[model samples]
Structure formats: structure tokens, C-alpha cells
Target: MGRRIGIKDVAAAAGVSATTVSHILNEVEGKRVNPETRQRVLETARELGYAPNGLARGLRLKRSNTIGFVSDQIATTPHAGRIILGAQEEAAKHDLLLLMLNTGGDPELERKEIDLLLQRQVDGVLYASMYHRVVEMPEQLRSVPTVLLDARSNDPGVPSVVPDEVLGGRTAVRELLSHGHRRIGFINNVDDIPATHGRLEGYLRALAEAGLAEDPRLVVTETADAAGGYRAALRLLQAAERPTALFCFADRMAMGVYRAAAELGMSIPADLSVIGFDNQELICDGLYPGLTTVALPHYEMGARAVVQLLALTGAQDQGTGPAAQEMLPCPLVARASVVSPPRL
Candidate 1:
């Protein structure tokens, strides 16, 4: 077996005392060392391929420069690549390593993962939910510096970074209204969910802002999935006050809306206009007329969450401030799905 290279070997090659080498390695300067000497020592260490044992350094500082990333089944999800890329960029900037653990969409497994991360002595934890929903965080995470990405929780102390769903929702509705859509309908998921409720609030707020009375019949609250949206659209179009423009909570649901419209002999933007959210790629490509949507900046959000977590970890270690909620605004992307209301 090859002998392990230690600080002593680098010190000997650099002509420096063991203590001086220790100081330089720890970045603790008791005495000012000449720049030339410092450079030589660093070079010798590099040439020797000598790396300080990370475990020893962590023990000395009582901290590990590693952060835990607890996420849903990102490995299997399409948007996973972008989000992971963002997180990696931010983590690299902070000189921190990420230990990612996926929960595979199981809350029980998520709980176990959190425990495992805590056991690993990670400095902080970043909890990322695949979708915008209310997450029940584990009790063990309360003591650790924790951040939630793309999810909301009742705990005020657990800071969250989420896409501004309300803003995105309003943007979707405003665009449709600008194109002369007054009889606008909504395809939303169950109102109990946080993101769903936020979108619903934005939808109602937009209607009220436009001086249009709320038409209960035009709003269909269902699963907001493709199939749910399909069924809801069928009933909505059959009604006496059939809406000419529809805003759905998700792009998947909007795909269902497209199916319902086709069955009713309606051509997009000609007899009906549709807009949705999330901007999922498949939905956009699958539709006959590409769906216009509110893009959530999913990748940016994931990266921002990592940056915020790093910041919080530093601040907490320094006793700087308490954690708080932050949000990123989503933007609208226009496509061929929507059109001006039928000629007055």
C-alpha cells in the first residue's frame, strides 16, 4: 500500500515549519507570512497531491461544508435536469458540496431521508418538492437550518422560496382579457392546495379588477390534471354561458381542455382560446396550436433556493438573522393558443 502524503511532506518540500504549514492550511495567521513563501507552500502541496483529510478539518471547525438536498423523484422527472443544474451552479459558487437524496414522491420516505441527512451532519437542508403544494416538514429539521423550495408550510421559521403563483395566474388572465376575452372560464384543481388556491385567488382578482362579476358556473374546480380538465371542459362548454377563453391551473389540464374543445367542433383562437400554467414542454408540443402559458422559472427557482440556503447557513452560523420567506416572480410566454374574442 502507498504511504499517505501528510502536511509534513509538503512542509518539508516548502522549507517551512510544521506549525507554519498548519497555520497556512487553516487560514489562521498568527504571524504575517511572506506572499512568496505562501505561494511556494501552496505549490508544493499541490504538486504533492496532498489533500487535508476533510473529516479532520470538519472536526476542528465543528462544521461540515456539505449541504443536504432532499427532493422528490427529480431523477425521473423531465424538469429535473434544469433544476439540478441550477442548484449545482449555486452550490459551486459557495464552495459547498450537495448531498442529494430523492424521496421518490413518498412522504414517509421523505421523512426517513431527512433523518438520514441529519445523521450525516450536514450543515443545512434544502427541501424541494416537485410541485407547488403544502408540505409537512419533519420535526427533526426544526433544529437545523432548513429551506423549502417550491412548497409552502405553516411553520413561519421554515423559510420558503416559491414561484409567485398569484402573479403568474393574473398574468395568464390579463393576457386573455387583453385579447378581448370577457367570458373567460377557469380550470383549476382542488382549492385546498396552496398553489391551486393562490391561482384561484389571482383569477378572481383579475375578473374583479376588470369590473367583471364572478360567474360561478364558468369556474370548474377538479383534479386540474389532463383527465379532470377534459371532463370539466365538456361540462363547461355544454353550459348556456360557454366561455370563449379558458385559463387552466396547469398545462396538463389545458391539454385536456384542447381535447374537449376539439370534440365540440371548436378551433383554437377561432371559436375558443386557451391559456395555462407551468409551461411544461410536452403540453406545449402536443397541442395542435401550442399552448400559451405562465412560465414558472423552475430552474432559476431551484438555483435561488440553493443560494438562499447557503446564505442562511452562513448567517445562522454567524448569528446574523432569522430565516424568512422569499418568492420569485413567474413570467408569461405567449404562443398560438389564444386569440381575440369572436368578432363583436
Candidate 2:
């Protein structure tokens, strides 16, 4: 309604040049300005309600101070929402605003969303997925400072922040082995996905380390859901040498194992020890006995993606080297589902 306070008003009131005020407010590195002048300029700006015009500033600096976050169903999913929260928090720490967009796993929608963000002149982009997999990055992303979250590009040139699935798998099996489980079976996801391969590799590695033979009969590949888990569990439980413990690829599948165990009149940890991955709280905590599982590190992946994207954007501005890929660790969450095997 009234007159808008400008940077010049703050400079005049603070008894300083516009250049000095710009340096102090924008925080241009290595520019030596007196502390007293800096404090005075900030106080004057606060008192005058001076807000910089984002568009004008962006045009001048060729940086929007805004990061674009594009995800395929991660933003809308309940369990994966933490990834967005983490990215937003980190962006705020650097005084950057985030523009979030969801594509619902549709390639056409993905391209449209990316084009829209580019048209808006976002400083950089963060591409994320609901699950860990290899994604083909759109050509538009190649020209911008882009980082992948919870996914990797087939091209090694793109930077990504993803969970260490192999380590998570090893940790799950190691927890079972520590409880004296020699006959442990694995209910795995289908072989095509990246997580399935990495997790299965860890499973086999842990078995080899423990001097146990790899048993084809003890492993079953499923669809990574409740129905698939139920069918796979039935097959394992009906075997002549039924496994005493089971490691599921995901918590959703673990729910199916619980159902099968119930049908067989088997008690959790008393008759069958179980462990799962992706520690979805709704499934894990609501189970009769809380399910012990490996966390997917969704929050960490999102936070690290922002950190990497900012770093890459800064590096590009400074003519530095290329961005590097990062993988965050998944921690084990102990609960009531796992216990020592019953003595035969």
C-alpha cells in the first residue's frame, strides 16, 4: 500500500555505499568489509523492511537462489515424504528456496515438469525417485547442475545420493546370524531392480563369510509386496527342511510372511525369527511384535542430495571439477520380531 523500502534507502540510512550494502547482504566471499559497517547495514535494512527483488537479483547474478526438486511419486507417498522434508530443511540452511514437482512415474509428465522448471530459470535441479533404481536422465538436465536422489543415472557423469543397499542387506543377515540362525531363508524382490541385485549380493556374501553353503531351496524371488511375500513364505515353510529364520527384502513383503506364520500357528521369535528392510513404521510397529528391520535412509538420501547439488552448482560457477556420487548408510533398527533360535 505504501512505498517499498529499497537497498538504496538502507545504504543512505546506514551511511554506507550501495556496493558495501550489497556485499554485506549478499555475503560475497573474500570481500573485506568492516564489522561495524556490516552490523549497521543489517540493522538499517531490518528497520526499513527492505526486501530484495528476487527476479532482479537473479537476472543480475544469473542465479535464482531457488532449487528445483523433481520426484517420481516420492513426494506423494506417505513413507517417502521424509525425503522432501530433508531436502527442504537443507535448502533453507543455505538460504535457498525449493520448488517441488511430482511426476507420478510417468515419463511424459517428467519431461513436461522438467521443461516447466527450466523455463522458470531455476538455479539447479534435484531428481529423485521413490525407490532405488537406474533412471535415464532427461536431456534438459544435462545442461543444468542436476543431482539424482535415491536413484542413479546410467551415465557415470551425473552425481547421485543413494542408500547403501548391499551394506543394509548384510546388516540384516548379520543380525539373524548373531542370534544363532544357521538355516535362514531370504524372501527377495525380483532380480531386475538394482536393490534386489545389491541386497542379494550382500546375502550371499554374508553366507560365504559364515562358512555356509548357498542353498537354492532357501531363497525365493517375489514381487516385493504382501501377496508375493505370502506365496514365497508358504513355499519356504512347506519345505522338508524349513528355515528357522527369514530375511525379507521389504517390510511390505514381511507383512505377508507374518500372515503365513499366523496360518501355521507359529509365534514370532518363538518359532520363527524374522527381519525385514525399509522399516516402514506402519507395518513394522503394528505387527503383533514390532518388526526389526533395516531403515532405507530416505531422509539422509534427500539431505545429501541437496548438499551435493549445491556443491555441484557452486563448483560449476567456480569452474571446478565434476561432482561425485555419494551413498549414505542404512542403520539397523532392533525390535521384538528377531530373537535367538529355539533349541531343537
> Where is the poorest 10-residue window by lDDT in model 2?
73-82
Give the true-structure RMSD of model 2.
4.3
Give the per-residue lDDT of model 2 (tens digit) for 1-344. 59999878899999999999999998899999999999999999999999878888888888788889998886546656788888888999998888888989988998899999998788889898888889988898888889999999878888999888889889999999999999999999985988999889889888988999999999999998999999999999989999999999999999999999999989998999999999899999999799999999988888889889888877876899586778788899999999998888
Provide the clashing-pair count of each candidate structure.
0, 0
Model 1 Cα displacement at 44 (Å)?
9.0
C-alpha TM-score for every candidate: 0.82, 0.85
**What is the C-alpha RMSD, rounded to one decimal, of candidate 1?**
3.8
Best by TM-score: 2
Question: Best candidate, lDDT-wise?
Answer: 2
RMSD of each: 3.8, 4.3
Residue-level lDDT of model 1, residues 1-344, one tens digit each, is: 48887889989999999888877876885678888888888899888988889988787887788888888877665777777777778878877788899988887887888888888788888888877777877787887888888886877777888888788888899999999899999989875776787888889889889999999999888886899989989999899878999999889899888888889898897999999898888888778799999988778977888878878877976888676677788798888998898874
Output the lDDT of residue 231, model 2: 96
Q: After superposition, how far is residue 104 of candidate 2 from its true place, in Å?
A: 2.4
What is the lDDT of every predicted structure here?
A: 0.84, 0.90
